[model samples]
Target: TMTIANSIPSEENNEYCNQFHSKYEPKEILGRGLSSVVRRCVEKSSKTEFAVKVIDLNNLDTNSEDARQDALKELRILRLVQGHANIILLHDHFETEAYIFFVFEICPHGELFEHLNKVVRMSEKRTRGVMRQLLDALEFLHSRQIVHRDIKAENILLDAEMSVKLTDFGFATEVETDDCLTDLCGTPSYLSPEILVVNMYESRSIRVYGRPVDMWASGVLMYTLLVGSPPFWHRRQMTMLRMIMEGRFSLDTPEWEEVSEAAKSLIASLLRVDPGQRLTSVQALAHPFFAKQELPCVTFDRRTRFRSAILAVRCLCRLHRAYAMPARLELRRLRADPYTIRNMRRLIDNTAFLVYSHWVKKAEDQNRAALFENSPKMDLAAQDSG
Candidate 1:
């Protein structure tokens, strides 16, 4: 009889951690996926935190032999993905009799979906910044002949400084053998038109296409970011599929008033109905939105500065919670960090920073002028009230 531990959830009853069992102590549940549950754990020896994804073989649709084969396939594919910043970093994976464990780098900030929902929307400049990094990641993956079949907001995560990191490779497939896959699997909203058509007809003769599918998904994501909801939304799945297949949508929203024409044009290019017409990662990189933007200088001191600034903010928030002190104290400490101040100075050198600075200054001046203009009216009203 299997006695369940209070620490593990009932759904994960069939799974148990065995690899490096002596090192890590499970802390809390991070999330639950279709076939696995991820937990945050701390390595006792190094005091380093990691995310452990436990997949139960008994819960899967496969027998022991098939489970082993699928595990090996996943491992091989994960190993092949090298030096991609956008993809999640897989440290190690091991299997026990009843479960498979995968150790990954802990992303403290959580998924992009959560962030976007919390904010409701992001600024065009910030959105472009994020998209650029995502494109770089995709470029690296496509260059390695890998197709991240699943690319959506949920799979994209944020690091401490709000840097984007792509996660979840369970649905990813590599394009190594010139094999066209027919398995239509991905979030429906982001699915390309071709996928909708195949699914509509229930045709097994259809084959999985190449990297363009990812590009189409990227376009959908771009649209989602610009407009609060997906390009096509319907109460019924079939109606949604019809909209996607027809490629009929308009961006003529009041929100478009604030977004740049260039940005809108890029979105149009990426969201083209024809996969072949969609912008490739390299071509997208060359767009004005990402063209010649200076990336942060890669240096040990710079890295330390950025990390310290982020950590200080996190620690300050935690301290405020624990001690019931004013959060401003944390802000003061953060501002006093010489490293952070210097990094801010360097950040001003970036083109984006310069553009933002100009706008900020202009807005500040206008605000001051508006206050002055309103003073006489306010004074008149006060006099009458008095």
Candidate 2:
């Protein structure tokens, strides 16, 4: 019953706006940004709740092509990702002269960092789980010849079970046939070196950047998830920008002492200075960090199928009870699909191998102890004893 296709010829209809208000009663204000206000609303018929993002066109200069394209681009990408499980779903949308309305699947748990802020830092297992969904969404976009220029944790939302849903494609763009794209439209700290700031007067210089910008941001995401802060963070803006441009970041922090080399390798590969050297989403998924010897492939047994279905339903009910999130039936469809089942099985299996376990921590402690035991003073004492 709800649909959002593409832009139509601007039509004047007060009835449409009035009908929208009648159909969905706004409950609570969820969030507000400069461009839009997100409100929790309930559809009168089904009584299902959804988040409504209201963009007031009056705030933007209608004559500015840049502003118009910026708003439309999000709708376009949302339309493109109709069936994508890891991407946010667009339930319904409408546009009037004064405002454009977007109804989205409500994600009650909120932003990834909001969760991270509570935990301080994530265990490797939790981080990997989150990163898997992020990579899945990114891979989906990349495959469709689209680049989500911004891949920050704030743009990632969560359901109750903590599965990620990637959102906010306002800066996303379709790659040309040449596979080249250029835009200085990402959070400055997360920006890749290639999104060069060209002077307005400079016509000769052509700055071409592409998907690797996302890879760089993923590396930053990886670091933040594991270490609780960005890799290139600095007190000064220029300093941070310089670090990103120069690819000057290190895994030599105290957190890295516990982190596995496999994780470090993935981060280094993603944060490569040259875009060509950066890991693609596919390659990153194939890296050792994500590898597992055995995957718990779903069985044909009826009990196993029933159990999975029940677990999923229970999870949904739990979330629904907490914050009234709408049923994400698309996810139920994915759970039924064998391909998603297999992929999830392997992703779950791989988390068992992360070095943050007790044995690795004990090994590190022993190694440090052994180094001190074999110190120069100990060596001298040993020689004297001999």
lDDT of 1 by residue, 1-386 (tens): 12113534555434443344565777778887656778887777888898888776767776866876676677776788755776678876766666677888888999887665544457787888889988888888888888888898888988777888887776677786424655688877778876765655765444546787788888878877764556766646677678887787777744466677888888888888777788899999898876565888775788789999999999999988887853333444333442234333234223333343333221212211121111112243345568
Estimate the TM-score for candidate 1.
0.69
Query: What would the TM-scores of all predictions be?
Result: 0.69, 0.70
Clashing pairs in 2: none
**Model 2 stretches with alpha carbons more than 4 Å out:** 1-17, 61-66, 177-179, 197-206, 295-386
lDDT of each: 0.69, 0.71
Per-residue lDDT value at 203 in model 1? 55
lDDT, candidate 2, at 254: 40
User: What's model 2's overall lDDT?
Assistant: 0.71
> Could you tell me the C-alpha RMSD of candidate 1 in Å?
15.3
